[model samples]
Target: MDNDCMNNIEDRKIIYQLINFAIKHKKIMQNYLDETGVYQAQHRLLMEIFHNQNASQNHIVKSMDVSAATIAVSLKKLEKGGYIKKEMDEVDNRLNKITITEKGKKVVEQSKQIFDSVDGRVFEGFTEEEKLTLFLLLQKLNDNLNSMEDELKSKKERK
Candidate 1:
């Protein structure tokens, strides 16, 4: 096979590995999230809010990469459970800003501990340099995906 074809085959294998890794990671995290009385999506959303207090619903929807409907459902559940509060944006009554409550902060702390432990488990044998390289490569891949999304959106707008 030509070198280019060989590289293509190797890249496909890498893609497959990445897909499998994501599936397994989700499954593992689900158990942890469940124990904390939140779904994986909710946990992620909570963490996002924890990082960005008083963020608008629209911002959360974009940052979480979840549908608006999904965000609504998750926010409702979180709010009902007293984990978060949704206050109307002072400048924009139409927009609701999400703020984590004291209860929600506790959850975030717990989740952070779980995540830190999980991270250790995932990278137990990896050296510091290997971990850094992996982080950089994943970031590059994420950037490429974002660019592809932007291009697709531009094309759609042009059409």
Candidate 2:
């Protein structure tokens, strides 16, 4: 095979591996998310709020890399479910500060235990050092991909 063709084939296999891994872990993650009655994407927002209470909706959407509409819809659903509260900023009413409700806190506290246990069990065979090394490698790969994405975007903008 030509070098380009070989690279294409390898890329496809890498994509397949990523999707397969996600499918395998979906069951483990979905069970916990379902029990909490939140979608996976919404859980990302919840986790963000758990760490950064009274966070601005715009900040959350930017950090989460989701569209404003998507974030708004999710926030509305969560608010209706009594998991979150959106309050107007004291100085700038244009910006909304989102806070996790007591109910949301309880959910996170319980779900965190489930998530931690699942993560531990998933890599039970790996030593602590192995886990750390794998994490660092994955982080490096993720950062490289992000940089490549930015480069592509810049090239497109120039064109």
Candidate 3:
């Protein structure tokens, strides 16, 4: 086969490996989250509220790039579970300010520990040098992908 064809095959293998890695990682995370009694979406929303205390629902919807309805549903679940509390905004009565409750803060801290442990396990067999090399390579790949996206957008705009 030609050199270009060989390169294409190698590229496909790399993409496949990346997809598998992502799937496996997700499964592991899901298993851990299950043990914590928090759904992945709720955990994500809780983390956002933890970091951005007193944020509005609309702000979370915008920041997360999700629909308001989706955020509202998660918020309702979280509030019912005592993970978060929604209070009427003092100045803006129309908007409710969302804040993480004490329970939610504990969950967030536990989630951090869980994530750290999982991350450590992920690189269990890798040396420090290998980890650093992988980080650099991934960074470069992300930069290249971003550049490609920008170029595509520019082309579309031109047309």
Superposition error at 54 for model 3 (Å)? 0.7
Q: How accurate locally is residue 103 in candidate 1, as Cα lDDT from 0 to 100?
A: 91
Candidate 1, poorest ten consecutive residues by summed lDDT = 5-14
> For candidate 2, what is the lDDT?
0.88
| Runs in model 1 lying further than 4 Å from the true structure | 1-9, 89-92, 139-159
Model 3, span 1-159: residue lDDT tens: 799977677777878988999999999998997876789999998999999999999999999999999999999999999999999999999999999988998999999999999999999999999999999998998999999999999999999
Candidate 3: residue 129 Cα off by (Å): 1.9
Q: Encode model 2's per-residue lDDT on 9-106: one tens digit a residue.
A: 76678668778987989877887778887877777788899999989999998888999999999999899989999999999989999999998888
Per-residue lDDT tens digits of candidate 1, residues 1-159? 799977668676878989999999988977886888877788889999999999999999898788999999999999999999999988989999899999999988988888898989999999999999999999999999999999999999999
For model 3, what is the alpha-carbon lDDT of residue 59? 95
Which residue pairs does candidate 2 place in steric collision? Answer: none
Each candidate: RMSD: 4.1, 4.9, 3.5
lDDT of candidate 1 vs native? 0.91
The per-residue C-alpha lDDT of model 2 at residue 15 equals 68
- Give residue 57's lDDT in candidate 2 (0 to 100): 92
Please give the lDDT score at residue 109 for candidate 1: 91
What is the clash tally of candidate 3?
A: 0
| CA lDDT, every model vs. true structure | 0.91, 0.88, 0.93
